[model samples]
Target: MRRRGMTRRSLVASAAGLVAAMGTGGDAAAARTARSVRGGAGGESVRNGGDESVRGGGGGEDRFARGEMRGVWVASVANLDWPSRPGLTAAAQRAELIAHLDRAVGLRLNAVVLQVRPTADALWPSPYEPWADCLTGVQGKDPGWDPLATAVREAHDRGLELHAWFNPYRVANHTDPARLAASHPARLHPEWVLPYGGKLYYNPGLPEVRRFVQDAMLDAVRRYAIDAVHWDDYFYPYPVAGQVFEDDAAYARYGSGFPDRAAWRRDNVDRLVREMGERIRETRQGVRFGISPFAVWRNAATDPLGSDTRAGVETYDDLHADTRKWVKEGWIDYICPQIYWHIGQSAADYAKVLAWWNATVRGTGVCLYVGEALYKAGDPAQPAAWQDPAELSRHLTLARDHEEAAGHVFFSAKHVAADRIGAMARVVADHYQDRARAPR
Candidate 1:
């Protein structure tokens, strides 16, 4: 088969690796995806990053997880992807969103993890918090319609599962309570929020804050037919240099029983994850509750069971997100760790991270999906390896070797649409040669 846009270097290396088709654009992307899904449009063979006979490579018959959770994140904060910018008419907003879902389906992906709660605010009309600034550029002003409801309808129509992504404790990207809506939960209960790293966050250590955020998010879950309730790697937020999270007042008030502050913080986040899981199951029996945590749980230097990498941050240590424990205990239905690194990365090898995560969820019933960094590919700020169109594809190639690596979710939607340097094209040709089912 012709390489199409594939660069010769990657094809020689064995090579590497859109839309809810709504209109013309959608039709084209969907056509490409349909061709791959329907037995590779005549069972065309693909040469993948030096592996000629691997899954979905030759005869396109060995594709994994036809039902796997293939997904992409549609970030709303700061106008990263949709609406192009904030304050678009409700009609325009809906169109942009449908376009994203169409893009996902066009790429043969079955899921879209859109950020409904970008910064402790709602993309939809919610009683818990005001409409997100990401939608109207004004915290409280409603856009006259619910984005989440529209998203569910459009996504389902395109045969894509919609995962409502929430940031449990984040209040705002800035550290000002007065600027918030008058009835905003954070403003009303300033004591429940903590200013850290120039940002405002609902104090995870506060019991009231935890329950309130859960309720706020669950309100949306109960109202929508979303396939999953998703949380990103922001449980306690990454640490800031020369600054400490001033939860001492909270710790003193509620953490007297724990042996230390770290344990108490871990317990706080643990409750959020555990209780959220239980509530999601109770509210919607099959609505999968999942988390896409920071890739590194803990460095092996600190814990032998940790991955063999020297990431500057650890979800368990700094962010207080016990990602591993959640998997072992089955507190989450799936763990989509953001292993956004290239293969052979010195600080965090994509191959090693995947293997570590594979072992992390081995027998736990929790599904495993590595969060790929499509956004990193070809970005000048990224390491030199990311400049290669095949780097991201190589990561997927490596993942095929791991039994527990169920699937992958790309970082964001725009990168896939860009197909920078043909990185995404390489992947479509290699692994996603056929349509697959998204895991529940």
Candidate 2:
């Protein structure tokens, strides 16, 4: 099976105007994603993420802030990057997680964005959600240890920030609720669930469902002293060919005079983003709320403000995620757009997208982190570009040209340790030689 990777937008005055039109309903529910583009597309060197002196890994516990974000994701779903497999003993799981964090430190990264809630479940026991099936291979069964607790302690000891990751609306990877634990929220409240593309998602359009999902996620926030609240590109699920997300009933019941279903759907996601941001701020003043959205917000042909990419699947029209608006409205602390393509690729050129995002995040107080696709490195199945030993490093080299390009986060942990084709080695040599804290 193919492993799925991460993917994210743009600017400020017109943004406020757009938000005003979207209505005050989003005021309480939005994520902290405001942004602006005062500068043009060229990148100046950023401070925390240095460009010079790329050698040596013994940058021993640098006391000063680097002002850049160097993070690695430790995905837990289906054992993509951790635990090796489901149902591992509690001691074994703890050891595996610690090893992943140690690997991050070895690579000179300062943050571990561990997925605490992959697929609408919790790594830490939660009153509102079931124990993650990814850990024990059975929903609601404890792995006999609190992964989040161990992660926070270990990451902090290494001077790394532990960002709690959540997949807000996903209930199950498959459509049937029978496979879910009997006490799972989806099974208890089937009305809030919708099946599309063989997966069950809590309908984003339903106000009650949105609130429930938020409350469920916030349970973790109140329980853990996490550095940030992180989400990925799963807002409305990637568009499936010939398959429609059946939410006509939701639209008819609550869309309330919106001209089209698309507008209503986008508003639903907007509310979720806005509210989550407000809640995070209220709960923990410094805890960041951020997202790693799909690369293309829209093709240039689709929207005059869109990036110059032509591949397909947009965040706005297809996934109902207004990525640009989130950045513009100050609904997120950071936006990590997974620019997982080669420098000169035909569909989505990495250089072009990087320039566009740097320009977009200039004045918004929101940081920009490039989501590097380390998983693709040295993979023969990938495009010929990734086959090059220096492909990943070249991405870092290009990012150095953008001032807003605060730092880079590799897709998952295992790939970085594997150093496939020595691609990761090249990136470290060229960009991460000096130990740096995650960009604030």
Candidate 3:
């Protein structure tokens, strides 16, 4: 998720101060120790000198070599992270992408989640959607080369797993269909589109819309050697304040058996996840499916099974994404919840939430990777904890206690590069001394 505006100078100074105070010469030694104790991805366990055992919720043991998923999200919507901005030459765009990948490798990270489809558009050649506007500043205008294809090849060459990220329903940031490409699917099928909260979305209620989106996203999975298929938290467009999603027509048409509108919406998202997972496996047996959902599923005050959080928004109730159900049913290969909060936050403490998710994925055969808010670190608008360079590093230190906490993915690539508060560098110094492969 994007954040409020940030000035780089002060944050940089803060990071420098922290580094100066802590000293940096011992980072290499610390990392070596971490590798030895944690066992570099797929390495022999330090304890039993054999495969590491993952204790399941049902008290079963699933054995595998210990590995961590150290990933960073490269957002493409509105050119937030890559291409620098729209209309850059293809050569320039490729250079910027290569730089991001190189930076990830330098950081000892193992995975890259590139947003190929930010809105209802494609970053590669697709029969289902037009070219992403972030590539050339004009929807449908080819950017002279395929970004996804290049990303997959370049990332793999650098020994990094490239996960193709897609936003399932978001069509456009604006409500005007006229701004879209002439052959845009949303424009082609008006009935499938809905204007909500100043943005346009393909109504999730329609069966055809769901199937078409699955087809659109799965196209890349079939065409490229992508490591995984990834989806962010935008399932139903976090409830708009005072405005409705306005999917009544499709709901009226297909909401026959569901308990209510919320249930029907959740079922729509569930079908998308379950069916997409099935198709991904069929398309490529080795390809994994994952979702990085909003951290809280439901506050304990609302549901007995929910996390002990007082979060204002719940994925289950507000966005109609039954994140917990998806994990229990094993619909996704991994669940990386965006626990974007501080350690001791009153509303939703990071440690408490991490524990909740650690338990949620246990025994389910699904990997759990915490999504870190790299963007928040040192941001003046954020809470005081974010101002501390050690804040993000502390998050990793905290995750070490959870057996199910396989790894973590930072919010974005730009922050990884900026290391504004030296937070990313602090994390590298403190926790990521040894590079770990993404969990299988």
- Quote each prediction's TM-score: 0.86, 0.86, 0.86
Q: lDDT by residue for model 1 over 1-440, one digit each (tens)?
A: 11223332332223111243245444433332232222111111111112232234322334442335578999987789876898899989888888888778777777899999988889888988898887888888989998898888877777777889998988888887988988798888888888889999889999998899999999987888887888999988788888779998989999988989999999999999999988986876557788999999999999998999999999888998889999876677778999988888899998888889988776454678889989988889999998998887787778767766767899888888887788888887776776665643
Find the number of clashing residue pairs for candidate 2: 28
lDDT of 2 by residue, 1-440 (tens): 00011012223343444456658744422222222222111121112233323222332232212256788988988789987899889999888888898888887888889998887788887998899998889999988989998898788777788888899888888988999988898888898899999899999988888998899888877777777899999998888888888898988899888889989999999999999988987876567788999988988989988999896888999898999998877788789999999999888999999998887876455778889999998999999989998998888777766767767889888898787699988878876767765654
What is the full ranking by lDDT, best candidate first?
Answer: 3, 2, 1
Per lDDT, the best of the predicted structures is 3
Steric clashes per prediction: 19, 28, 1
- The model with the greater TM-score, 1 or 2, is 2
> Between which residue pairs do clashes occur in model 3?
56-363
Estimate the TM-score for candidate 1. Answer: 0.86
Runs of candidate 2 exceeding 4 Å displacement: 1-66
Error of 1 at 90 (Å): 1.2
**Alpha-carbon RMSD to native, per candidate:** 11.9, 8.0, 13.0
